[model samples]
Target: MTEGKWDEKFVVFLKKYYWDDILQLANSYPDQRSLEVDFYDLDVFDREIANELLFNPDEVMPSANNALQQIDLPVEKKLIDAKVRFIKIPNKIPNRDLRSKHLLQFVAIEGMIRKATEVRPKVLNAAFQCMRCEHVTMVPQNEIKFVEPVECENETCGRKGPFKILVNQSVFVDAQKLQIQESPENLKGGTQPQSLDVDIEDDLAGLVKPGDRVIINGVLRSHQRTTREGKSPFYDLVLHANSIEYTDLEFDELEITPEEEEEILALSRDPEIYQKVIGSIAPSIYGYEEVKEALSLQLFSGVAKHLPDGSRVRGDIHMLFMGDPGVAKSQLLRYMVKLSPRGVFASGKSASSSGLTAAAVRDDLGDGRWTLEAGALVMADMGIAAVDEMDKMSTEDKSALHEAMEQQTISVAKAGILATLKSRCALLGAANPKYGRFDRYEGIAQQINMPPALISRFDMIFVLLDTPNEDMDSKIAKHILKSHYAGELSEQRKNLPSSTITQEQVDGHMEVIKPVIDPDFLRKYVAYSRRNIFPVMEDDARDHLVKFYMDLRRMGDGKDAPVPVTARQLEALVRLAEASARLRLSNVANMDDAKRTTRIVYSCLRQVGVDPDTGAFDVDVIASGTSKSQRDRIKIVKEIIKSVGEKHPGGKAPLEEVYAEAQNQQIDRQHAEDLIARMRRSGDLIKPDKEHVKVV
Candidate 1:
């Protein structure tokens, strides 16, 4: 009698036919009639129904008592009608806990799951967020878990970490995973309808169409899928997260409001606010226009602590600013910290590794369990984090942030807690060129406080040279004086007209931009980036590489900040350019962007890259003034090896003996070691023995 509606009848049939024990209702919606019930539990639960019903702690059902009897704790206990006998047993035992290792054991046994695994159903909520400004969000509260840890490349919002989890209902149970189409036909307006990998098995992989949130249990990858035979799979299943469960629901039938619709519309129209906050103070710090531009990008696109719109942050955008003493870098950094919605600016010497990411500290709240304190990056996630005096920090502390900057997530095993935190944020940083001041004509790398591996992750770096000129110094002094004493400089801005867009509006942009990118140009561009652009070899290679990037971008409508060129290489290309372009608030990637990225690359390349002449790239050429002695030592080492054997007419000497010779010249030990490494790499010298040296 109640089965007249086809949808309702289908739901009933599925419940009775597909599942068992269907009476207990899970959470529900407005109309019970519209609800689809699960009767037969699927292989979704981490435990059996019986075990879960018995042991689960969150539920409040009477069956829970019958479900679990008791667990035997490690301490032994016995009772015999008020009479007891004591027995002693040694602590050592044979193979007390011998079990084969499994991935699940790693996650589950380590308390990922508090109960035994079982067949079950799962429901979760998630939101799609823009990585840049955080002005965009799409939350499907009644959906499956679709959030995976990722670095957010939301334009200037260098925020990174665990992104919004998609709701359970947004998943598609019957779509297919599409193939990667490289042809022009597929390339133009290339957006294929989104489908699930498990369903039709032919939809686009690692992609989410507008208003679409996929719920699957593997890491979501962003590129093409292929096999061992060199043949492309119909779909590239780029993994985002693993071990999945799901349910899908349509949005139209849900109780969505027009206000929500309007918010979505408004978000679609707001121009990309990849423009960084200029914090009036930064502009006041004269000279270092290049450094200022770099820092501006850091506010908009570097490793920030948060997204501008207050969304989850993720992904790569590391940056550093090296300058001379009295360069006003710290003052500028302090101002930037306030401009960001969520930001932290701290001195390098004052921070610990734990303070940079996480710390197990005594919480004054009085819970004896030590609590976790998120450092500048973690707390500033989804926003900007300005670090002052970078070189003064400990090497260990600097290393702690390497993963946070690149991975956009912070995993810590501190106190009694094993936790992974989201820390996707932009980073605006400052440092002295060395313990003293910078050297004119030198790249900032000479005095960087961190490691080279860490250095490479930054989208770009800038040198804040304080070259004193008669005109520039006077200007700087006057500006500082004005900022300090002028009553006109109170921290206030002229009231701008009401912004047409709200944070919520920015969070709702799918319906607008979807039509713009239906061709999936972003995907192709990303592929091209990963495939080609980033690892540049030579000048000609850079020329050829840029075309692929330009062509891929030409494929997309210019609505966003030359949005995601899927490839990390493409990101490098775009990032380098955009960091420059952001300086003047231009929406497009202009010459400035190209030059900025190229300069940073050039600076880095100059340090490690080969030069045709003199057989050395010459850190002295780039690392000019920070340390004359260091540069001299690099040259000295080359000269020494070149002079060895040929000048004295003897077999090549041991490196130790070479160092002994260097010591005679009053060379510092650290400087001597560096000289040897560079000499060995340059083919000027070789290790005949582990410690012995020879001319190459």
Candidate 2:
């Protein structure tokens, strides 16, 4: 078709279908310079024109813009260089599938923004003044290299000479570069995720940051790869964005049919729903019933509360597993990642501080300027992040998680880029004990290599010790053997004929390890509950939680008693109760939910917070790395040293005298010696000589 005909058709189409939209754009001119037109509307108006626009955007875009300019509005001022942007284009392509055939064609691509460059002014039209004749020339710019006029535009005096740029007169627009990668959840095994560069201009430049899932409609353009030798045969693809739509809504990609929704609702109504959910998580792993229960609740997390004062209470739960080497901690974590609709699994040994949080790096598209890159936590926004081997990470690297786990945001202030990115995801971290095995006599905080402050942030901490028990060990061995047998049979069945291995034999072995609820259905169920269910605490439930908290707090009423729990545990109880209600698809948390949460919290506290010596709950064991009894003994040892040192020269007390004095204060001889050694190791007390000690 001729350009005039195409222009005439677009003008008629606009007047017929977009007259009101055009007037609105004109009223908001300069501020809203682009008018978005739906591709469906265009297709409905003229299918041929729509097809032409999809296949030949470069030719159709100019005609469409010219037609838009011809439209006259009642406003006093005319729209200056208004744009007509297409959206909801039917030709959707995956980043990995983009090919040369799709070049110059209008298509839509969906991915997460892995990196973004700062917005800067890019010249669209250059205004150059010819030095010879003092004549001004306006040249359009499109390629990376700047274009200059061959000669002067003035016909009276044409000369090829240097020209000075009139920066003020040049037409420039805000432009940014983005690197978008395919979502990890969508990739098949053994395949690396593919990424594509995108160029967004005007109002779309600063609208998206790293970790944002977006569907962008644009024309795919290719540039030849050039090296120092010359141009290479390969070409790099870049999308010139026309319009972008954010898909960051939770579980937006999980499409639940009406049948599936009904199934989920039906499952929630089952009497043994909690049991089924627990059984579904790592069913092959022998046992850790309470751990699996907590994981189940973590999937259907509590509602995030946004207070009117602008503060936010994170509803996501954080859990830590510190265990022996033979335990299946990493297996449980990997299974959770598979069950989650959106999840990222990162190993601490391989991930740096910036890799787990966010990084500011200089990329090719940034032209030496720093580009902010999203990390595992940010990529797992609104979902789950399973970090395995957390003990292998350096202290400096692990510190990066403190803010992300608490505030649900990653604040980056590197290389002039200061921005807060969302990391509202549940953390499932697994670590090993310092000595490769737990010491039942010591506090959990002392056994784990992590700091107490970080340890206290976890909603629940489970210690999976490899204790010897005949009945339990036998059951675990059987479960492991059955799982391996099932896997072997499945592999054999794939290669052997049905006659060689009957289906019944394979099914018999698989039944031992198969989950009660299908994994895919479970993932959809979790997404549905999170999206639709926001349970409010009932009066009865609230009272129950308050009573439980008070009962624990009352245990520490005496002056010498240890603190049983802190307010953090109370908040965790509330979150767990809410999650319990969500799992049942109930709108209110009742007595049952409260009771269930209390049971789980009590079990966790008994494992990690109870002081071995006193056999009493002391939150300080996890909060301060010292139990009440231990602190008291240390205080007595300090006073004894201070008084005993006065009797000797240079304020140095003999070790035997200090121990004897501590024994007189009701501390045992063995306990007193251990305290002194601990204090010496901590730098609180220094050994002045072979047999004397002095406080620093």
Alpha-carbon error at 353 in model 1, in Å? 1.2
Which candidate should be chosen as best, given lDDT against the real structure?
A: 2
* Candidate 2 TM-score, true structure as reference: 0.78
Predicted candidate 2 versus true structure: per-residue lDDT over 62-159, tens digit per residue: 99999998877787777657889998888999898998899999999998888888899999999999888889999999887789989888999788
Q: Write candidate 1's Cα lDDT for 1-696 as tens digits.
A: 121232233333434443222221111211111122121221132124323322231231222211111212133421111100001111111111212221111011000110111112332333555444553444443322344435555655656644554444333321222211111111225344222222111112223321122233222223344579875745433222222222111211223346744543343244532221222225545455445545555544521135677764343356666666776767777765654545566677888788778777664323244656556677566566777777778888888877777777889997787999877676767777565875443344455556666655655555655665898778777766654533222222123344344434333432221223222222222222222222212454356447755554453344322221224435555555544333333345545456556555555343332222233332222322223344556677656665654544455665665676678787857768866876677687777668556666
Q: Predict model 1's lDDT versus the native.
A: 0.44
Alpha-carbon TM-score of each model against the true structure:
0.40, 0.78
Whole-model lDDT, model 2? 0.90
C-alpha lDDT of all candidate models, in order:
0.44, 0.90
